[model samples]
Target: MIDTEILGWRAALVGELDHRRLKAPSVKLRSAQGAADGEAIYCVDLRVRHPNADHYLTSTELHSVEHFLLEGFMRLLPAHFVSVGIMGCQTGFYLAFRNEGRAGRLCDTLEQILAAIEHAREVPYANIEQCGNYRNHSLADAQRVAREILARRADWLDAA
Candidate 1:
């Protein structure tokens, strides 16, 4: 069973999204739980655009962004990093982490990652053997989306 206290924290985390002006490219805490090993696990939805928005990330853009994000987080936060996976809706990604309490720090690291993506010249691991659909990736589209997300960094987290 999930702890009551943890549920409250989850509520608070989800509440942060209520205050966001720009719905797209924002991070929303989806769930949090305490592990048997005494660690807190956080699952966040990295919304590329509002769920209700008319457009979504193209397959190529999503694939490229997924590659960049996975590589970037692994490089930047290996200690706390868990994994990043593309959303089925093609609107964003799901980011998981362990024992990370500071939303501000996450935001900072995300901005850095996005900045790197903005300037990235190539998508990581796009080779035939490395990726299933290697041909369906675009560095330019990924860069464009990264810039859009960076522009709304302030909306990534709620006011403390």
Candidate 2:
């Protein structure tokens, strides 16, 4: 990482972060000040940006995926994981895990999650009684993305 400050806040130019050259999905861990206990927190990002691809996930895919990942991780890592969310730009997911050791397990955990996504019959909580806009879930698109991720998993797994 190259620190290149611009206007005010600190920043760094992360090398090989380009979507085109990426092999597998990976997250970078960084410690920072600001938490409930005033201790450093570890942050990780599971980016899904594709190179030269301007298109993003459709609304249905996004809606379904959110519920799937949230529940999936809650089932997978239990207490060690914090949260799973989609990136605002629609490029990928954001996962916040506890510490460095979790980073090592990130790829494997995601592989399992993707496998579940591939085999799932429907989005977990897509019901009028369960969710606000529950009709917008799309299992097809979610599975498509899961296949894509699985294809690239080897590339990323090695890096992670």
Candidate 3:
């Protein structure tokens, strides 16, 4: 059931997005397992660019972005849960999907979903008492990134 035409969104995003490892140019990733296949899941990191590369996000903002995707993806792919978490740089999120075989199918669905999210205005789990660190959500940044991802989809989203 492997797809020959689709490169998969995880790989495409990893190939197209501004990866930190690639950005640094000097750092190299090592393995404790001594160079294994690494993972069975599909992982994609989504990033946003500010005018200055130095411009990073606040904790709350990162929280918002994480929560937004956590909610969106969970709802979008209800058959399976989606793990959406923030990158260490606070510029993006890491999405891990256990159903690796569905990457191509998900990519097609994601393009349609992302294309429809015109202006996102809410962070999913922004509860002061319920969430570990609340009030750290930014609908503005989330919306910006959503729009950005949609616009960049033509470059990074296609499965081919």
Candidate 4:
């Protein structure tokens, strides 16, 4: 079952984002669809499927990583864009921007997100108790999700 520890992680992420300066002037979460919804936006998907696994990162972890990545993106790629958030079937976290013009900017951001995941793998997540589903997962499990997602993303790049 999905855990509450995951939610604590979400709160931490939100807190982190609140403290940072995002590159995009406008970023937000929504349930709508279309270009107007994502135009000039920097979309982030906390819920990414692994090519060969049924398991996925808990929503809390995804949201936490989104916050971590958002800080990195603002620092690394400050291109103008919008932000959109959504709840995914497996998990939910996003920052969608408008148009395909920001693809290059997004690639750079994605790279940093992957790097952060790798770096956090060995680092302890003392924030577990504060996450939405603390009892459901562990640092080890988060690391596994990171490894699996990173590998899948790499494969995606190679295939593209």
Top-scoring candidate (TM-score): 1
Alpha carbon lDDT at 1, candidate 2: 22
Can you write out model 1's per-residue Cα lDDT over 54-134, one digit (the tens) per residue?
A: 688898989999999888888988999999999887889989998874566677788888899866779999989999999
> Candidate 4's residue-wise lDDT over 70-108, tens digit each?
555555555543553434544334665444323334545
TM-score of each: 0.84, 0.72, 0.63, 0.46
Query: RMSD per prediction, one decimal?
Result: 4.0, 6.6, 6.7, 13.9
Better of 1 and 3 by TM-score: 1
List runs of model 1 lying over 4 Å from the truth.
1-22, 158-160
Judged by lDDT against the true structure, how good is candidate 3?
Answer: 0.52
Which residue pairs show collisions in model 2?
Answer: 24-156
Best by lDDT: 1
Q: Is candidate 1 or candidate 2 better by lDDT?
A: 1
Which prediction has more favorable TM-score, 1 or 2?
Answer: 1
Ranking by TM-score: 1, 2, 3, 4
Question: Taking the tens digit of each residue's C-alpha lDDT, what string does model 3 give over 1-160?
Answer: 2232253323322334334433310111110111244434455545544313786767766676667667667777766544767778765666766544354555555555554445554566678766886766677766665666566654543322
Each model's lDDT: 0.77, 0.62, 0.52, 0.42
Task: List pairs with backbone clashes in candidate 3.
Answer: 60-136
